[model samples]
Target: MPTAHEVFNTRFVKAMNERNYDEYEALLTDDYVGEYPQSGEVIRGAKNARAIVEHYPGGLPQDNIDTRSTRIAATDARWVRTPTFTFVRAEGTGNVGVSAVRARYPDGSAWWVVNFYELRDGRLARSTTFFAPAFEAPDWRKPFVEQREAPAER
Candidate 1:
Protein backbone atom coordinates (compact mmCIF):
# COMPACT_ATOMS: atom_id res chain seq x y z
CA MET A 1 0.00 0.00 0.00
CA PRO A 2 1.15 3.52 -0.72
CA THR A 3 1.76 6.00 2.07
CA ALA A 4 -0.68 8.85 2.57
CA HIS A 5 1.77 11.31 1.10
CA GLU A 6 2.21 9.12 -1.94
CA VAL A 7 -1.53 9.08 -2.51
CA PHE A 8 -1.58 12.84 -2.01
CA ASN A 9 1.09 13.45 -4.61
CA THR A 10 -0.20 11.06 -7.27
CA ARG A 11 -3.93 11.11 -6.61
CA PHE A 12 -4.86 14.35 -4.89
CA VAL A 13 -2.73 16.47 -7.20
CA LYS A 14 -3.92 14.53 -10.19
CA ALA A 15 -7.51 15.30 -9.26
CA MET A 16 -6.76 18.99 -9.06
CA ASN A 17 -4.93 19.01 -12.37
CA GLU A 18 -7.72 17.07 -14.00
CA ARG A 19 -10.27 19.52 -12.58
CA ASN A 20 -12.08 16.65 -11.05
CA TYR A 21 -13.32 18.55 -8.05
CA ASP A 22 -15.51 15.70 -6.89
CA GLU A 23 -12.58 13.34 -6.70
CA TYR A 24 -10.53 16.00 -4.95
CA GLU A 25 -13.27 16.60 -2.45
CA ALA A 26 -13.33 12.91 -1.66
CA LEU A 27 -9.79 13.20 -0.37
CA LEU A 28 -10.78 15.95 2.04
CA THR A 29 -12.64 15.59 5.27
CA ASP A 30 -16.17 16.84 5.44
CA ASP A 31 -15.22 19.62 7.83
CA TYR A 32 -12.04 20.51 6.03
CA VAL A 33 -10.66 24.00 6.61
CA GLY A 34 -8.27 25.98 4.47
CA GLU A 35 -6.59 29.26 5.22
CA TYR A 36 -4.66 31.80 3.18
CA PRO A 37 -2.96 34.19 5.58
CA GLN A 38 -1.82 36.65 2.91
CA SER A 39 -5.35 37.18 1.67
CA GLY A 40 -6.98 36.67 5.06
CA GLU A 41 -9.29 34.15 3.45
CA VAL A 42 -10.71 31.11 5.13
CA ILE A 43 -12.38 28.28 3.27
CA ARG A 44 -14.52 26.10 5.43
CA GLY A 45 -15.92 22.81 4.13
CA ALA A 46 -15.03 20.92 0.99
CA LYS A 47 -17.96 22.12 -1.10
CA ASN A 48 -17.05 25.77 -0.73
CA ALA A 49 -13.46 25.11 -1.65
CA ARG A 50 -14.56 23.13 -4.62
CA ALA A 51 -16.78 25.98 -5.77
CA ILE A 52 -13.93 28.48 -5.68
CA VAL A 53 -11.77 26.41 -8.01
CA GLU A 54 -14.67 25.56 -10.25
CA HIS A 55 -15.20 29.22 -11.05
CA TYR A 56 -11.74 30.61 -10.61
CA PRO A 57 -10.88 34.14 -11.90
CA GLY A 58 -14.37 35.07 -12.97
CA GLY A 59 -17.03 33.90 -10.55
CA LEU A 60 -19.63 33.75 -13.28
CA PRO A 61 -19.26 31.91 -16.54
CA GLN A 62 -18.34 34.85 -18.76
CA ASP A 63 -15.36 36.20 -20.70
CA ASN A 64 -13.99 38.79 -18.30
CA ILE A 65 -10.38 39.46 -19.07
CA ASP A 66 -10.11 42.22 -16.49
CA THR A 67 -11.40 39.99 -13.74
CA ARG A 68 -9.25 37.11 -14.83
CA SER A 69 -6.12 39.28 -14.99
CA THR A 70 -6.77 40.78 -11.59
CA ARG A 71 -7.27 37.39 -10.06
CA ILE A 72 -4.15 35.99 -11.76
CA ALA A 73 -1.97 38.87 -10.58
CA ALA A 74 -3.28 38.76 -7.05
CA THR A 75 0.15 37.71 -5.81
CA ASP A 76 1.54 40.88 -7.46
CA ALA A 77 3.99 39.81 -10.19
CA ARG A 78 4.28 39.65 -13.93
CA TRP A 79 5.35 36.07 -14.64
CA VAL A 80 6.14 34.80 -18.12
CA ARG A 81 4.46 31.55 -19.13
CA THR A 82 1.35 30.08 -20.64
CA PRO A 83 -1.19 28.68 -18.18
CA THR A 84 0.59 25.89 -16.32
CA PHE A 85 0.29 24.19 -12.97
CA THR A 86 2.81 21.70 -11.71
CA PHE A 87 3.78 19.98 -8.50
CA VAL A 88 7.03 21.32 -7.07
CA ARG A 89 7.28 19.14 -3.98
CA ALA A 90 5.21 17.03 -1.61
CA GLU A 91 6.36 15.07 1.38
CA GLY A 92 4.76 13.87 4.55
CA THR A 93 4.80 11.23 7.22
CA GLY A 94 1.76 9.81 9.00
CA ASN A 95 -0.93 12.49 9.14
CA VAL A 96 1.05 15.62 8.36
CA GLY A 97 2.19 16.73 4.94
CA VAL A 98 3.79 19.66 3.17
CA SER A 99 3.02 20.20 -0.48
CA ALA A 100 4.16 22.90 -2.85
CA VAL A 101 3.10 23.81 -6.36
CA ARG A 102 3.84 26.40 -9.02
CA ALA A 103 0.74 27.71 -10.75
CA ARG A 104 0.91 29.81 -13.88
CA TYR A 105 -2.07 31.79 -14.99
CA PRO A 106 -3.38 32.69 -18.39
CA ASP A 107 -2.08 36.23 -17.90
CA GLY A 108 1.50 34.96 -18.07
CA SER A 109 1.95 35.30 -14.33
CA ALA A 110 3.12 32.53 -12.05
CA TRP A 111 3.18 32.05 -8.29
CA TRP A 112 4.10 29.37 -5.83
CA VAL A 113 1.69 27.89 -3.33
CA VAL A 114 2.98 26.07 -0.30
CA ASN A 115 0.44 24.07 1.65
CA PHE A 116 0.87 22.71 5.13
CA TYR A 117 -1.79 20.08 5.49
CA GLU A 118 -3.03 17.86 8.24
CA LEU A 119 -4.93 14.67 7.73
CA ARG A 120 -7.59 13.09 9.91
CA ASP A 121 -9.15 9.72 9.22
CA GLY A 122 -6.95 9.49 6.13
CA ARG A 123 -8.46 12.62 4.63
CA LEU A 124 -7.32 16.19 4.55
CA ALA A 125 -8.60 17.99 7.63
CA ARG A 126 -6.81 21.32 7.43
CA SER A 127 -4.61 23.19 5.02
CA THR A 128 -2.76 26.45 5.51
CA THR A 129 -1.34 27.85 2.33
CA PHE A 130 1.14 30.63 1.59
CA PHE A 131 1.56 32.25 -1.79
CA ALA A 132 4.65 33.99 -3.17
CA PRO A 133 5.75 35.29 -6.52
CA ALA A 134 9.15 34.52 -8.02
CA PHE A 135 11.63 37.37 -7.83
CA GLU A 136 15.25 37.99 -8.70
CA ALA A 137 17.70 38.10 -5.82
CA PRO A 138 18.81 41.59 -4.80
CA ASP A 139 22.36 42.68 -5.53
CA TRP A 140 22.87 43.52 -1.86
CA ARG A 141 22.76 39.79 -0.97
CA LYS A 142 25.33 38.80 -3.63
CA PRO A 143 28.35 39.57 -1.43
CA PHE A 144 27.20 37.46 1.50
CA VAL A 145 25.74 34.48 -0.35
CA GLU A 146 26.65 32.04 -3.09
CA GLN A 147 24.31 32.49 -6.03
CA ARG A 148 22.62 29.48 -7.58
CA GLU A 149 20.10 28.95 -10.29
CA ALA A 150 16.49 28.57 -9.21
CA PRO A 151 14.94 25.12 -9.41
CA ALA A 152 13.42 24.37 -12.78
CA GLU A 153 9.59 24.38 -12.84
CA ARG A 154 8.37 20.82 -13.24
Candidate 2:
Protein backbone atom coordinates (compact mmCIF):
# COMPACT_ATOMS: atom_id res chain seq x y z
CA MET A 1 0.00 0.00 0.00
CA PRO A 2 1.23 3.48 -0.75
CA THR A 3 1.61 6.10 1.95
CA ALA A 4 -1.27 8.52 2.50
CA HIS A 5 0.62 11.23 0.66
CA GLU A 6 1.36 8.94 -2.23
CA VAL A 7 -2.23 7.77 -2.39
CA PHE A 8 -3.55 11.31 -2.31
CA ASN A 9 -1.23 12.47 -5.09
CA THR A 10 -1.75 9.54 -7.43
CA ARG A 11 -5.49 9.35 -6.82
CA PHE A 12 -5.77 13.02 -7.65
CA VAL A 13 -3.80 12.65 -10.88
CA LYS A 14 -5.47 9.42 -11.93
CA ALA A 15 -9.02 10.46 -11.13
CA MET A 16 -8.65 13.62 -13.13
CA ASN A 17 -6.80 11.94 -15.98
CA GLU A 18 -9.47 9.26 -16.25
CA ARG A 19 -12.33 11.74 -15.86
CA ASN A 20 -13.79 9.56 -13.13
CA TYR A 21 -15.95 12.30 -11.65
CA ASP A 22 -17.36 10.32 -8.74
CA GLU A 23 -13.97 8.88 -7.84
CA TYR A 24 -12.42 12.32 -8.05
CA GLU A 25 -15.07 13.86 -5.83
CA ALA A 26 -14.56 11.14 -3.27
CA LEU A 27 -10.98 12.33 -2.77
CA LEU A 28 -12.02 15.62 -1.30
CA THR A 29 -13.46 16.41 2.11
CA ASP A 30 -17.06 17.52 2.61
CA ASP A 31 -16.01 21.08 3.45
CA TYR A 32 -13.31 21.26 0.84
CA VAL A 33 -12.18 24.64 -0.42
CA GLY A 34 -10.13 25.44 -3.52
CA GLU A 35 -8.50 28.72 -4.33
CA TYR A 36 -7.35 29.67 -7.80
CA PRO A 37 -5.27 32.77 -7.41
CA GLN A 38 -4.65 33.32 -11.10
CA SER A 39 -8.35 33.39 -11.86
CA GLY A 40 -9.26 35.14 -8.64
CA GLU A 41 -11.81 32.40 -8.02
CA VAL A 42 -12.69 30.40 -4.92
CA ILE A 43 -14.81 27.28 -4.93
CA ARG A 44 -16.14 25.66 -1.81
CA GLY A 45 -17.20 22.08 -1.08
CA ALA A 46 -18.68 20.06 -3.93
CA LYS A 47 -18.64 23.17 -6.06
CA ASN A 48 -14.88 22.92 -6.14
CA ALA A 49 -15.06 19.39 -7.47
CA ARG A 50 -17.80 20.40 -9.86
CA ALA A 51 -15.74 23.28 -11.09
CA ILE A 52 -12.78 21.00 -11.71
CA VAL A 53 -14.99 18.60 -13.60
CA GLU A 54 -16.73 21.33 -15.57
CA HIS A 55 -13.88 23.67 -16.29
CA TYR A 56 -10.53 22.93 -17.97
CA PRO A 57 -10.61 22.01 -21.63
CA GLY A 58 -8.74 18.90 -20.62
CA GLY A 59 -11.90 17.44 -19.10
CA LEU A 60 -14.32 18.18 -21.93
CA PRO A 61 -16.06 15.11 -23.32
CA GLN A 62 -14.14 13.92 -26.32
CA ASP A 63 -12.87 10.62 -27.69
CA ASN A 64 -12.64 8.21 -24.79
CA ILE A 65 -8.97 8.58 -23.99
CA ASP A 66 -6.58 10.17 -21.50
CA THR A 67 -6.03 13.62 -22.97
CA ARG A 68 -4.69 15.38 -19.93
CA SER A 69 -1.16 16.75 -19.88
CA THR A 70 1.80 14.40 -19.60
CA ARG A 71 3.26 14.98 -16.12
CA ILE A 72 6.92 14.90 -15.16
CA ALA A 73 7.82 15.05 -11.48
CA ALA A 74 11.24 15.98 -10.22
CA THR A 75 13.06 17.11 -7.08
CA ASP A 76 16.11 18.49 -8.91
CA ALA A 77 16.14 20.96 -11.80
CA ARG A 78 16.17 18.44 -14.62
CA TRP A 79 12.71 17.40 -15.74
CA VAL A 80 12.15 13.63 -15.92
CA ARG A 81 8.96 12.08 -17.24
CA THR A 82 7.00 10.28 -14.50
CA PRO A 83 3.47 9.86 -13.18
CA THR A 84 4.42 9.97 -9.50
CA PHE A 85 4.33 13.45 -7.96
CA THR A 86 6.85 14.94 -5.57
CA PHE A 87 5.22 16.60 -2.57
CA VAL A 88 6.53 17.93 0.73
CA ARG A 89 4.62 17.13 3.86
CA ALA A 90 3.76 19.70 6.47
CA GLU A 91 4.43 19.17 10.15
CA GLY A 92 2.17 16.93 12.26
CA THR A 93 -0.01 13.92 11.41
CA GLY A 94 -2.54 15.95 9.47
CA ASN A 95 -1.89 15.39 5.77
CA VAL A 96 -0.59 18.55 4.17
CA GLY A 97 1.39 18.57 0.93
CA VAL A 98 3.03 21.08 -1.33
CA SER A 99 3.54 19.72 -4.84
CA ALA A 100 5.47 20.97 -7.82
CA VAL A 101 3.95 19.75 -11.06
CA ARG A 102 5.44 20.04 -14.53
CA ALA A 103 3.17 18.94 -17.31
CA ARG A 104 3.03 19.10 -21.08
CA TYR A 105 -0.28 19.94 -22.68
CA PRO A 106 -1.72 17.95 -25.55
CA ASP A 107 -0.55 20.65 -27.90
CA GLY A 108 2.94 20.34 -26.39
CA SER A 109 2.74 23.57 -24.38
CA ALA A 110 4.14 23.12 -20.90
CA TRP A 111 3.78 24.69 -17.47
CA TRP A 112 4.99 24.39 -13.93
CA VAL A 113 2.32 24.28 -11.25
CA VAL A 114 2.37 24.49 -7.49
CA ASN A 115 -0.42 23.04 -5.40
CA PHE A 116 -0.85 23.41 -1.66
CA TYR A 117 -3.13 20.82 -0.16
CA GLU A 118 -4.54 20.31 3.29
CA LEU A 119 -6.24 17.05 4.07
CA ARG A 120 -8.71 16.06 6.73
CA ASP A 121 -9.32 12.37 7.45
CA GLY A 122 -7.31 11.39 4.38
CA ARG A 123 -9.38 13.58 2.07
CA LEU A 124 -8.46 16.92 0.66
CA ALA A 125 -9.94 19.62 2.90
CA ARG A 126 -8.44 22.65 1.19
CA SER A 127 -6.09 23.45 -1.62
CA THR A 128 -4.65 26.44 -3.45
CA THR A 129 -3.03 25.92 -6.82
CA PHE A 130 -1.45 28.10 -9.44
CA PHE A 131 0.15 27.47 -12.82
CA ALA A 132 3.35 29.29 -13.64
CA PRO A 133 4.75 30.21 -17.02
CA ALA A 134 8.34 30.87 -17.82
CA PHE A 135 9.24 34.45 -18.68
CA GLU A 136 12.33 36.12 -20.04
CA ALA A 137 14.32 38.23 -17.65
CA PRO A 138 14.06 41.96 -18.15
CA ASP A 139 16.72 43.58 -20.34
CA TRP A 140 17.27 46.27 -17.71
CA ARG A 141 18.75 43.67 -15.35
CA LYS A 142 21.29 42.50 -17.93
CA PRO A 143 23.48 45.51 -17.32
CA PHE A 144 23.25 45.18 -13.56
CA VAL A 145 24.34 41.55 -13.49
CA GLU A 146 26.96 39.43 -15.19
CA GLN A 147 25.75 37.18 -18.00
CA ARG A 148 25.58 33.49 -17.12
CA GLU A 149 24.07 30.36 -18.61
CA ALA A 150 20.39 29.96 -17.82
CA PRO A 151 19.38 27.03 -15.62
CA ALA A 152 17.62 25.32 -18.51
CA GLU A 153 20.85 25.28 -20.52
CA ARG A 154 22.93 23.80 -17.70
Candidate 3:
Protein backbone atom coordinates (compact mmCIF):
# COMPACT_ATOMS: atom_id res chain seq x y z
CA MET A 1 0.00 0.00 0.00
CA PRO A 2 1.21 3.49 -0.73
CA THR A 3 1.82 5.85 2.17
CA ALA A 4 -0.54 8.78 2.74
CA HIS A 5 2.10 11.23 1.52
CA GLU A 6 2.68 9.20 -1.60
CA VAL A 7 -1.02 9.18 -2.28
CA PHE A 8 -1.23 12.91 -1.73
CA ASN A 9 1.76 13.74 -3.86
CA THR A 10 0.64 11.52 -6.71
CA ARG A 11 -2.91 12.79 -6.61
CA PHE A 12 -1.76 16.37 -6.33
CA VAL A 13 0.42 16.04 -9.38
CA LYS A 14 -2.37 14.28 -11.15
CA ALA A 15 -4.70 17.13 -10.36
CA MET A 16 -2.21 19.58 -11.72
CA ASN A 17 -1.73 17.48 -14.81
CA GLU A 18 -5.44 17.12 -15.36
CA ARG A 19 -6.25 20.72 -14.43
CA ASN A 20 -8.75 19.58 -11.86
CA TYR A 21 -8.81 22.69 -9.77
CA ASP A 22 -11.52 21.53 -7.43
CA GLU A 23 -9.76 18.28 -6.71
CA TYR A 24 -6.51 20.14 -6.22
CA GLU A 25 -7.96 22.49 -3.64
CA ALA A 26 -9.61 19.62 -1.84
CA LEU A 27 -6.21 18.19 -0.91
CA LEU A 28 -5.08 21.35 0.82
CA THR A 29 -5.72 22.54 4.35
CA ASP A 30 -7.54 25.80 4.92
CA ASP A 31 -4.23 27.34 5.93
CA TYR A 32 -2.09 25.45 3.50
CA VAL A 33 1.25 26.97 2.70
CA GLY A 34 3.50 26.39 -0.32
CA GLU A 35 7.01 27.72 -0.27
CA TYR A 36 9.41 28.08 -3.19
CA PRO A 37 12.85 28.65 -1.74
CA GLN A 38 14.40 29.18 -5.13
CA SER A 39 11.90 31.90 -5.95
CA GLY A 40 11.85 33.15 -2.37
CA GLU A 41 8.07 32.96 -2.53
CA VAL A 42 5.57 31.42 -0.16
CA ILE A 43 1.99 30.93 -1.26
CA ARG A 44 -0.85 30.34 1.19
CA GLY A 45 -4.45 29.16 1.14
CA ALA A 46 -6.42 26.93 -1.22
CA LYS A 47 -6.89 29.69 -3.76
CA ASN A 48 -3.23 29.44 -4.65
CA ALA A 49 -3.82 25.95 -5.92
CA ARG A 50 -5.88 27.44 -8.68
CA ALA A 51 -3.17 29.97 -9.25
CA ILE A 52 -0.80 27.15 -10.05
CA VAL A 53 -3.04 26.08 -12.88
CA GLU A 54 -2.88 29.54 -14.32
CA HIS A 55 0.91 29.51 -14.18
CA TYR A 56 1.18 26.23 -16.03
CA PRO A 57 -1.46 26.96 -18.62
CA GLY A 58 0.01 24.42 -20.96
CA GLY A 59 0.14 21.84 -18.15
CA LEU A 60 3.21 20.06 -16.74
CA PRO A 61 5.35 18.05 -19.11
CA GLN A 62 4.97 14.29 -19.12
CA ASP A 63 7.64 12.32 -17.23
CA ASN A 64 8.00 8.94 -15.48
CA ILE A 65 10.58 6.70 -13.81
CA ASP A 66 11.51 3.03 -13.43
CA THR A 67 13.18 1.47 -10.38
CA ARG A 68 15.00 -1.86 -10.40
CA SER A 69 15.00 -2.21 -6.64
CA THR A 70 12.23 -4.57 -5.62
CA ARG A 71 11.96 -2.75 -2.32
CA ILE A 72 11.11 0.51 -4.11
CA ALA A 73 8.47 1.16 -6.75
CA ALA A 74 8.85 1.27 -10.50
CA THR A 75 6.78 4.34 -11.31
CA ASP A 76 6.24 3.76 -14.97
CA ALA A 77 4.43 6.95 -15.87
CA ARG A 78 3.53 5.52 -19.26
CA TRP A 79 0.14 5.22 -17.55
CA VAL A 80 0.29 8.97 -17.03
CA ARG A 81 2.42 10.31 -19.88
CA THR A 82 4.53 9.11 -22.74
CA PRO A 83 8.35 8.63 -22.47
CA THR A 84 8.17 8.20 -18.63
CA PHE A 85 10.47 9.84 -16.04
CA THR A 86 13.47 9.26 -13.74
CA PHE A 87 13.64 9.78 -10.01
CA VAL A 88 16.50 10.52 -7.62
CA ARG A 89 14.62 9.88 -4.35
CA ALA A 90 10.93 9.15 -4.12
CA GLU A 91 9.63 7.97 -0.76
CA GLY A 92 7.07 9.09 1.72
CA THR A 93 5.43 8.57 5.08
CA GLY A 94 1.90 9.40 6.22
CA ASN A 95 2.88 13.05 6.47
CA VAL A 96 5.60 13.51 3.88
CA GLY A 97 6.25 12.35 0.32
CA VAL A 98 9.04 13.18 -2.04
CA SER A 99 7.26 13.60 -5.35
CA ALA A 100 9.33 12.70 -8.39
CA VAL A 101 8.46 15.09 -11.21
CA ARG A 102 11.17 16.28 -13.59
CA ALA A 103 10.87 17.20 -17.23
CA ARG A 104 12.06 19.51 -19.96
CA TYR A 105 9.77 21.98 -21.65
CA PRO A 106 9.08 21.54 -25.32
CA ASP A 107 11.22 24.64 -25.73
CA GLY A 108 14.20 22.82 -24.18
CA SER A 109 13.99 24.44 -20.76
CA ALA A 110 14.15 21.90 -17.98
CA TRP A 111 13.51 22.15 -14.28
CA TRP A 112 14.06 19.81 -11.36
CA VAL A 113 12.17 20.32 -8.17
CA VAL A 114 11.65 18.42 -4.94
CA ASN A 115 8.41 18.98 -3.13
CA PHE A 116 8.39 18.55 0.66
CA TYR A 117 4.95 18.22 2.12
CA GLU A 118 3.71 18.62 5.66
CA LEU A 119 0.29 17.20 6.19
CA ARG A 120 -1.83 18.02 9.21
CA ASP A 121 -4.76 15.85 10.16
CA GLY A 122 -4.92 14.34 6.70
CA ARG A 123 -4.64 17.65 4.88
CA LEU A 124 -1.65 19.44 3.42
CA ALA A 125 -0.70 22.03 6.01
CA ARG A 126 2.53 23.20 4.47
CA SER A 127 4.74 22.43 1.50
CA THR A 128 8.24 23.68 0.87
CA THR A 129 9.48 23.36 -2.72
CA PHE A 130 13.07 23.57 -3.86
CA PHE A 131 14.01 23.88 -7.53
CA ALA A 132 17.42 23.15 -8.98
CA PRO A 133 18.86 24.24 -12.28
CA ALA A 134 20.64 21.50 -14.17
CA PHE A 135 24.07 22.66 -15.26
CA GLU A 136 26.66 20.99 -17.46
CA ALA A 137 29.43 19.53 -15.34
CA PRO A 138 32.57 21.66 -15.49
CA ASP A 139 35.44 20.11 -17.46
CA TRP A 140 37.71 20.85 -14.51
CA ARG A 141 36.17 17.90 -12.63
CA LYS A 142 36.60 15.33 -15.45
CA PRO A 143 39.54 13.61 -13.68
CA PHE A 144 37.60 13.14 -10.44
CA VAL A 145 34.26 11.90 -11.71
CA GLU A 146 32.79 8.91 -13.42
CA GLN A 147 29.94 8.93 -15.92
CA ARG A 148 26.61 7.54 -14.86
CA GLU A 149 24.77 4.92 -16.86
CA ALA A 150 22.20 6.34 -19.26
CA PRO A 151 18.66 6.36 -17.93
CA ALA A 152 17.57 3.59 -20.30
CA GLU A 153 20.57 1.49 -19.27
CA ARG A 154 19.75 1.85 -15.61
Candidate 4:
Protein backbone atom coordinates (compact mmCIF):
# COMPACT_ATOMS: atom_id res chain seq x y z
CA MET A 1 0.00 0.00 0.00
CA PRO A 2 1.24 3.46 -0.75
CA THR A 3 1.18 6.16 1.87
CA ALA A 4 -0.60 9.43 1.32
CA HIS A 5 2.67 11.29 1.09
CA GLU A 6 4.04 8.85 -1.45
CA VAL A 7 0.87 9.06 -3.46
CA PHE A 8 1.00 12.81 -3.48
CA ASN A 9 4.63 12.90 -4.57
CA THR A 10 4.05 10.33 -7.27
CA ARG A 11 1.15 12.28 -8.64
CA PHE A 12 3.20 15.45 -8.75
CA VAL A 13 6.04 13.71 -10.57
CA LYS A 14 3.68 12.10 -13.03
CA ALA A 15 1.97 15.39 -13.75
CA MET A 16 5.30 17.00 -14.61
CA ASN A 17 6.39 14.08 -16.74
CA GLU A 18 3.15 13.88 -18.70
CA ARG A 19 2.47 17.61 -18.83
CA ASN A 20 -1.10 16.93 -17.83
CA TYR A 21 -2.25 20.33 -16.76
CA ASP A 22 -5.68 19.19 -15.71
CA GLU A 23 -4.37 16.33 -13.61
CA TYR A 24 -1.79 18.61 -12.05
CA GLU A 25 -4.42 21.17 -11.20
CA ALA A 26 -6.50 18.58 -9.42
CA LEU A 27 -3.66 17.76 -7.03
CA LEU A 28 -3.23 21.32 -5.90
CA THR A 29 -5.47 23.09 -3.44
CA ASP A 30 -7.61 26.03 -4.48
CA ASP A 31 -5.33 28.45 -2.68
CA TYR A 32 -2.03 26.74 -3.40
CA VAL A 33 1.17 28.72 -3.23
CA GLY A 34 4.35 27.96 -5.20
CA GLU A 35 7.86 29.33 -5.26
CA TYR A 36 9.73 28.69 -8.48
CA PRO A 37 13.48 29.04 -8.74
CA GLN A 38 14.10 28.96 -12.47
CA SER A 39 12.08 32.11 -13.10
CA GLY A 40 12.34 33.71 -9.68
CA GLU A 41 8.57 33.77 -9.51
CA VAL A 42 6.26 33.33 -6.55
CA ILE A 43 2.86 32.08 -7.58
CA ARG A 44 -0.25 31.97 -5.46
CA GLY A 45 -3.27 29.73 -5.90
CA ALA A 46 -3.82 26.78 -8.21
CA LYS A 47 -4.42 29.10 -11.13
CA ASN A 48 -0.94 30.56 -10.89
CA ALA A 49 0.74 27.20 -10.39
CA ARG A 50 -0.96 25.86 -13.49
CA ALA A 51 0.08 28.87 -15.50
CA ILE A 52 3.69 28.52 -14.43
CA VAL A 53 3.82 24.83 -15.28
CA GLU A 54 2.39 25.53 -18.71
CA HIS A 55 5.17 27.97 -19.54
CA TYR A 56 8.06 26.40 -17.65
CA PRO A 57 10.80 24.83 -19.72
CA GLY A 58 11.40 21.07 -19.39
CA GLY A 59 7.88 20.52 -18.15
CA LEU A 60 7.38 17.99 -20.91
CA PRO A 61 9.63 17.78 -23.91
CA GLN A 62 9.46 15.53 -26.94
CA ASP A 63 12.99 14.45 -26.19
CA ASN A 64 13.81 11.81 -23.61
CA ILE A 65 13.56 12.68 -19.91
CA ASP A 66 15.19 10.72 -17.12
CA THR A 67 14.99 11.46 -13.40
CA ARG A 68 17.46 9.48 -11.32
CA SER A 69 17.55 9.40 -7.54
CA THR A 70 20.91 9.61 -5.85
CA ARG A 71 19.70 9.56 -2.26
CA ILE A 72 16.45 9.30 -0.30
CA ALA A 73 15.59 9.36 3.41
CA ALA A 74 12.24 9.15 5.13
CA THR A 75 10.89 9.22 8.63
CA ASP A 76 8.25 6.81 9.98
CA ALA A 77 5.49 9.43 9.87
CA ARG A 78 7.18 12.75 10.01
CA TRP A 79 8.93 13.74 6.79
CA VAL A 80 11.06 12.48 3.94
CA ARG A 81 14.69 13.44 3.83
CA THR A 82 16.52 15.14 0.99
CA PRO A 83 16.67 13.40 -2.36
CA THR A 84 19.09 14.43 -5.06
CA PHE A 85 17.46 14.37 -8.46
CA THR A 86 19.55 13.89 -11.58
CA PHE A 87 17.41 15.01 -14.46
CA VAL A 88 18.77 13.94 -17.78
CA ARG A 89 17.62 15.43 -21.06
CA ALA A 90 18.11 13.29 -24.13
CA GLU A 91 20.06 11.09 -21.73
CA GLY A 92 22.04 9.22 -24.34
CA THR A 93 22.23 12.21 -26.63
CA GLY A 94 24.88 13.92 -24.50
CA ASN A 95 22.58 16.58 -23.12
CA VAL A 96 21.67 16.24 -19.47
CA GLY A 97 20.42 18.30 -16.54
CA VAL A 98 20.37 17.64 -12.83
CA SER A 99 18.69 19.21 -9.81
CA ALA A 100 18.69 18.53 -6.07
CA VAL A 101 15.59 18.97 -3.92
CA ARG A 102 14.98 18.63 -0.21
CA ALA A 103 11.36 18.39 0.88
CA ARG A 104 10.30 18.91 4.49
CA TYR A 105 6.91 18.43 5.99
CA PRO A 106 5.63 20.37 8.96
CA ASP A 107 3.20 17.64 9.81
CA GLY A 108 5.76 14.88 9.29
CA SER A 109 5.15 13.26 5.90
CA ALA A 110 6.98 12.97 2.66
CA TRP A 111 4.88 15.11 0.36
CA TRP A 112 7.37 15.98 -2.34
CA VAL A 113 7.77 19.55 -1.22
CA VAL A 114 10.67 21.90 -0.66
CA ASN A 115 9.19 23.99 2.09
CA PHE A 116 6.44 23.65 4.65
CA TYR A 117 3.09 23.79 2.87
CA GLU A 118 0.38 24.54 5.33
CA LEU A 119 -2.84 22.78 4.47
CA ARG A 120 -6.04 23.80 6.09
CA ASP A 121 -8.82 21.25 5.75
CA GLY A 122 -6.83 19.71 2.90
CA ARG A 123 -6.44 23.08 1.21
CA LEU A 124 -3.04 24.61 0.61
CA ALA A 125 -2.54 28.00 2.16
CA ARG A 126 1.18 28.77 1.91
CA SER A 127 4.42 27.20 0.62
CA THR A 128 8.03 28.06 -0.15
CA THR A 129 10.98 26.63 -2.11
CA PHE A 130 14.57 27.69 -2.72
CA PHE A 131 16.27 26.68 -5.94
CA ALA A 132 19.95 26.44 -6.72
CA PRO A 133 21.72 25.92 -10.03
CA ALA A 134 22.15 22.29 -11.03
CA PHE A 135 25.50 20.57 -11.03
CA GLU A 136 27.06 19.37 -14.29
CA ALA A 137 30.21 17.77 -15.61
CA PRO A 138 32.81 20.25 -16.79
CA ASP A 139 33.43 18.27 -19.94
CA TRP A 140 30.21 16.59 -20.98
CA ARG A 141 32.02 14.35 -23.42
CA LYS A 142 33.98 12.71 -20.64
CA PRO A 143 30.94 10.84 -19.40
CA PHE A 144 30.57 8.99 -22.69
CA VAL A 145 34.20 7.97 -23.01
CA GLU A 146 35.23 4.37 -22.40
CA GLN A 147 38.83 3.83 -21.37
CA ARG A 148 40.70 0.64 -22.37
CA GLU A 149 43.81 -0.68 -20.66
CA ALA A 150 46.91 -1.98 -22.48
CA PRO A 151 47.60 -5.72 -22.45
CA ALA A 152 49.49 -6.92 -19.37
CA GLU A 153 52.43 -9.35 -19.62
CA ARG A 154 53.40 -11.90 -17.02
Identify the candidate with maximal TM-score: 1
- Say which prediction, candidate 1 or candidate 2, comes out ahead on TM-score: 1
What stretches of model 3 exceed 4 Å from their correct place?
55-89, 149-154
Determine which window of 10 residues in candidate 4 has minimal summed lDDT.
88-97
Q: Residue 102, candidate 3: how far off, in angstroms? A: 0.7
Model 1 lDDT tens row, 1-154? 7666866766776666556678988888889999999999999999988887776652222343433233333332533223345776778978899988887666555678889999998789999999888677799999999977765332
The lowest-lDDT stretch of 10 consecutive residues in candidate 3 is: 65-74
Per-prediction TM-score: 0.75, 0.63, 0.66, 0.46
Evaluate model 4: give its lDDT. Answer: 0.46
Q: Put down candidate 3 lDDT per residue, 1-154, tens digits, no spaces.
A: 7666666666776665454668878888888989888779888887886576546533333334321111122244422222122344457665776665664433344556677777888777888878665566679998999966432221
Residue pairs with backbone overlap in model 1: none
Best by lDDT: 1
Query: Which residue runs does candidate 1 get wrong by more than 4 Å?
Result: 1-3, 58-83, 152-154
Residue 17 miss distance in model 3 (angstroms) = 1.3
CA lDDT scores, all candidates in order: 0.72, 0.63, 0.60, 0.46
User: Residue-wise lDDT of candidate 2 within 8-103, one digit each (tens)?
Assistant: 777777676666668788888878999999999888896567666656543344454344554434444443332222232333245777766554
| 100: Cα error in model 4, Å | 7.3
Clashes of each: 0, 0, 3, 2
Report the lDDT tens digits of candidate 4 across residue range 1-154. Answer: 6444444445655665455678878877887777656568778788888887677532233334342322233444533222222121111111111222333222223223244345444334555555433233357677897544412110
